[model samples]
Target chain A: MIRIEDVSLRHGQTQILHDIWLTIPKGGITALVGPNGAGKSSLLSLIARLQPLQAGRISVDSFPVDTTPSRDLARILAILRQDSIVTSRLRVRELVGFGRFPHGRGRLTPDDYAIIDQSLQQFDLTDLSDRFIETLSGGQRQRALVAMAFAQGTDYLLLDEPLNNLDMFFARELMRSLRRIADENGKTIVIVLHDINQASAHADRIVAMKSGRIVADGTPSDLLTPKTLQAVFGFQMRVETFDDMPVVLHFR
Target chain B: MSIAATKQASKTGWVAGLTLAVLFVFSLCVGVDDMPIIRLFSDGRALELLLVSRLPRTLAAILTGAGLAIAGLIMQTLARNRYVEPSTAGTAQSAELGILLVTLLLPSASLLFKSLAASAAALLGTSLFLMTAHRLPPTQPFLVPLFGLVYGGVIGAAVTFVAWQADLLQYLSVWTNGDFSGVLRGRYELLWLGALMVVVAWMVADRLTIMALGRDASIGLGLDHARMLQLGLIIVSVISALSVVVVGMIPFVGLVVPNIVSRLMGDNMRGTLPTVAVSGAILVLGCDILGRLIRYPYEIPVGTVMGCVGGLIFLWLLFRRPSHV
Candidate 1:
């Protein structure tokens, strides 16, 4: 379980995250949904130890984030940031292979290669494995980045806006892949998402935030109501049942 | 196709290595005193000339070429810009300042002492450059190298003023303008240390490439980004400073060779560094040879030749990155 307590962040006088407490259990998909500047990414970053804990304690599977060695933490947790720009001309396979870096001396054994191959297959990136990342389309490159994170073989995966470049079809496919991984592999996934429908469709639990505070936390049906939506997003959106899942029509 | 590319890369490595070896042996025979290939074993004078002059010059040229190229590659990786080499980042200029200070303060200091001091100075200057560079908004990647160029210019201008005040203009020119015409056995051995540093670079090539992925990604992969940044700066400084103290500053070996090799071989540093190093040797040795032959013993400095050649290639590199990437 990942536990965050009294976490707060400030950049100069501007507060990015208020005193926040969240506990994310192991072995399922948890989605963080919020409006712009809702501190969703900041909360995830703190959980993954990407940003240093400014005023609170965070522990992942009993390992205190700030105190534990990074190498040890890396084995248990993997994170994919939204603004990852790979300037190096790395082939997709080589790029994915870096996920194994914390495991060994950077040389991949056959078992590691098997894991890498599996990750590539998972993301539908096998065909593009040999292509340089620079040559990949934005969506394809995003998949490669995701494959790299998956190949980390960590217990918990923290992905901030992984669906940014992907279109609807690919986005659904990626969400389905995450769902499968959570079901079969029993990995814990903490994803910050802009698409509430995808989160409702795929996420096991939804955590809603506004102005650096978690305003609602429960299953999709509990959090997607018109009253909760208005309280969280500051706007009214119609929520309807689709295939027994609450799908919000926020565009109109 | 990946297998084929791997095979192709290995093939390229072999061909480059063999060609460099042959050219090295051939360069051993190119100087003022004509020592034919057959006479070295039979003639003592020819053997002396070979050991005392041709061999050291050839080795120095190759090592300087290889070292500067690798330094440039590491610098670019650390800076995350194709345009910033050690020369552009104030590293080489700081090394010059080191040499000048030592010359004024300790006239009797040995060559080894001078080179070490220069390396130390280069390390400090480059470290400061990278630290301040960290503060610049990363959205404007172009600003980093431009900042480096201006940073290097300020250091260079300081170096010039110091030299002028001390009436050490001639000494400054000798260190600034790279040449192998004066290389002899005892004079150019420090570059062997530079070669050893290249091996160190190769050992950490994977980490270096990881570094090119930017800070968050690199740290996410369990690398201590701060330590790796220091290691990179040290390697770049020591190598570039060694070349500066040994043969002055060969401008483009580090800047142009890696860019060209990366264009061909992608940025898997472990796989591409040998090719980069060998290609650097080729460029420097080729230019040194041209320098020798162009003036027909009257001689142009290798630094001058590279400034013209590398400057042109760098212009192409500058304009190419945005459109190409």
Candidate 2:
């Protein structure tokens, strides 16, 4: 479980996140959805400790994120940011192998390699294992990056906008993979998603943010309503039931 | 790594080793002195000349080449820009400033103390560059190197102005134009420090490679990114400072050699570092040989030779493809 208390972030004169207090329980997929500038990404970065917290307390599984050694925290949480640029020309397998760095430092044991192989297989990256990352398409690269985080073998995965640049098929495929990992492995996933329908269809719970504050938090069925969408996005959204799942249609 | 890649890497290693050995022998043999190759074994005077002049000069060239190349590699990785070499990033200029300051303030300081001062100055300069780089917009990657070049030019100009006012312009010019003609047994010992830095860099190769994944990924991988960055900066500072002090500023060797090696082999520093080091040494040896042969007794400076060659290559690299930077 990840816990946040009174987190506030300011960039220059602008406040990015204001008094964000949220608790993400263990062993489930929770999707954070918001409009642009709603601070969804900022909150994710804060929880992952990618950005330093100015006024907040965050803990993952009873370990304070600020005080815990990075290596110790890495075993409990792994984050994949949207703009995690890899400038080095590394093979896909090599990139995934880096996920085991927290465990082995640099020298990988046989067990670590087995786990790496499992991660590659889990993401269907076996065929592209030896390919350079720059050669892959955007969706393939996104999958590789996610696979790298998965290979870390952390109990909690925090992904910020993983669906960016992904086609509809790859986006659904990635969401399904995240769902499967959550159900079978009992790994907790906190993902920031832009597509509300995807969140409604795949996520167990949806947390909506507006103006840097959490406005709604509940199951997809409760949160994905026309009135709630209007409050969060400041525009009316059409919500329809499809196969017992509430699909948000905000495009029109 | 696959079996084929491992085999290929070893093959490259063996070939590079053999070439370096051949170049080392050739460098020792071809000098201004008329000592016969055969007489090197039998004649004491010829052997002394080889030991005192040719051998030290060859070793100095090799060390400077390897050190600057490795320094450039680290800087490029840290800056996330291929064009950020020691000279371009103002590290060499900062070292020059240190030399000028030491000459004025502590006229009788030991060579070791002078090198340390220069190393400290290089560290300061590189840290400043890193801070400025961190604040720049990442959308235009070319701006990073452009900023470095401009920043280095400002530092270089300031050093030159101070040297002129102090009536030490001649001294400054000699150090600025890198030449191995002054290298002898006693003069080239500072390069050993550079060799030690290379060894240290090799030991931390994996950590350095991990750093290339950028800040978020490095931290995500449990690396103390700031500490690793500081370590890399220190290594780069020491290497750049020592090379500048020992051999003067050998431009483009650092930038060109590492870029070529990275293009051929991937950026896994553990796998590619030795090759980068060896290639740097070979390039310097080859250029020094060319410089010696080009003008005979009136030898051109290796720095000038490398500037010409490296400049052409750099321009080609800039225009060759539409890079991310």
Candidate 3:
């Protein structure tokens, strides 16, 4: 379980996240959907300890984020931050292998390599494993990044916009991959997503945010109505059912 | 991407090691008052010269080369910029400034004192550059190195002005021009300290490689990013300062060698560090030999030759496709 209590973030003079309290239980996919500047990424970063918490308490399992040793916390929690750019000339397998660092400290055992290869296979990246990351297309690189985070072997994963740069086919494939991992491995996944329909389809729970505050939080059927969507996004959009799922017609 | 390529990279590594060995032997051979290969067994005076001058000079060249190349690799990781090395980023100039100021204050200070002063100033300068370089728009990556060039130029000009006011121009020239002709048995042992920094770097090679992934990624990977950064700063500053103190300022060995090796062997420092070290040693040794042969009787400074050779390679690095971004 990941717990966040009374979390607030301020950047310069602006309040980015205001008294945000969220508790995510172990297993399942929780999608944080919001408009721009809604503090989804900021909240995720604070929980992941990517940035120092200003006024909050966050813990993964029983370990306090503020006081926990990074290595210890990393063995349990992995994060894929938005805007993560790797400029190094690294092959895909080697890059994914970096995820095992906290465990092996760069001296990877055969077991660690198996985990890396498994991650590559999970993301359908086994063939592209030896390709340089720079040579991969943007979508392929995004999948590689996601694969690396998965290779960390952490129970709880915090991904900020992992679907960015991915085309429709890969994006849906990635969401399905997340769903498979969440179901089979019982991994606790918290994802920040932009496309509402994607969240409505794959997310077990959707937490909608607006103006640095959570406006609505519940299952997609209850929380993703047009009224809540308008309140969260400041615009009206029709939410209809397709194949027993809420397919949000957000387009004009 | 194939087993063949991996085999080929190792092949290249072996070939580079061989080339470096050949260059090391050739460097020992090309000095003035040449001792033939048989002279060591035949003549005692020639043997004494080899131990006192040739051996020390060659070792210092190799050590300084390896040290600065590793330093450059670390700096690039820490700064997250490929183009900034010690000489281009005001580190070497800051060391020169610190030495100049210390000399003006106390003309009779010990060599240790001078080196400490140089390292301190170098640390400050490098940290300042790394801090500011990130603030510039990273979209145009050339801007960081360009700012670094100007920053190094400003520090260098300040050093020159101070030296001129005190009429220490000759002293300045001796310290600024990198030449190993003055190296003797006990004189150049400070580079061994720089070599120790390399060993420490190799010990923490994985952490340094993680740093290339940037701060957030490094922290996410469970590295103590701030501590690793401090270690990297100390390593670069100490190596740059030691080289400046011992051999004046050898330009481009740091910048040129690391990039070439990275292009060939990727960024895993643990896998590529030895290659980077050997490649750097070979470049410097080869340049020193070229400086010897380019003018037979009178020797050209190694720094001057490197400025030409490294500058051309640097231009090629600048204008190349940049390895597909």
Among the numbered candidates, top lDDT falls to 1
Clashing pairs in 1: B69-B254
Per-residue CA lDDT of candidate 2, range A42-104, in tens? Answer: 888877788888998999998988888999988889999988877788888889998988998
* Structural RMSD, model 2: 1.3
Q: For candidate 3, write residues A45-115 as lDDT tens digits.
A: 88888899999799889789999999998899999998989899889998999999999888989899899
**B1-325: candidate 2 lDDT, tens digit per residue:** 6566668778888888899999999998887778898877899999899889999999999998888889999999989888789988899999999988998999999989999999999999999998999788888787898999999999999999999999999889766878899999999898998999999999988889989988988888788999989999999999988887878898998888888877767788899999999988998888898899897877999999999988998788768756545
Candidate 2 docking classification: medium
DockQ order of candidates, top first: 2, 3, 1
Worst 10 residues of 2 chain B by lDDT: B316-325
Q: After superposition, which runs of candidate 1 have C-alpha atoms over 4 Å from their true positions? A: B318-322
Alpha-carbon runs more than 4 Å astray in model 3: B1-5, B322-325
**Scoring each candidate complex against the real one, what DockQ results?**
0.72, 0.77, 0.73
Q: Which 10-residue window of candidate 1 chain A scores lowest in summed lDDT?
A: A42-51
For each candidate in the order shown, give its overall lDDT on alpha carbons: 0.91, 0.89, 0.90
**Candidate 3 falls in which docking quality class?**
medium
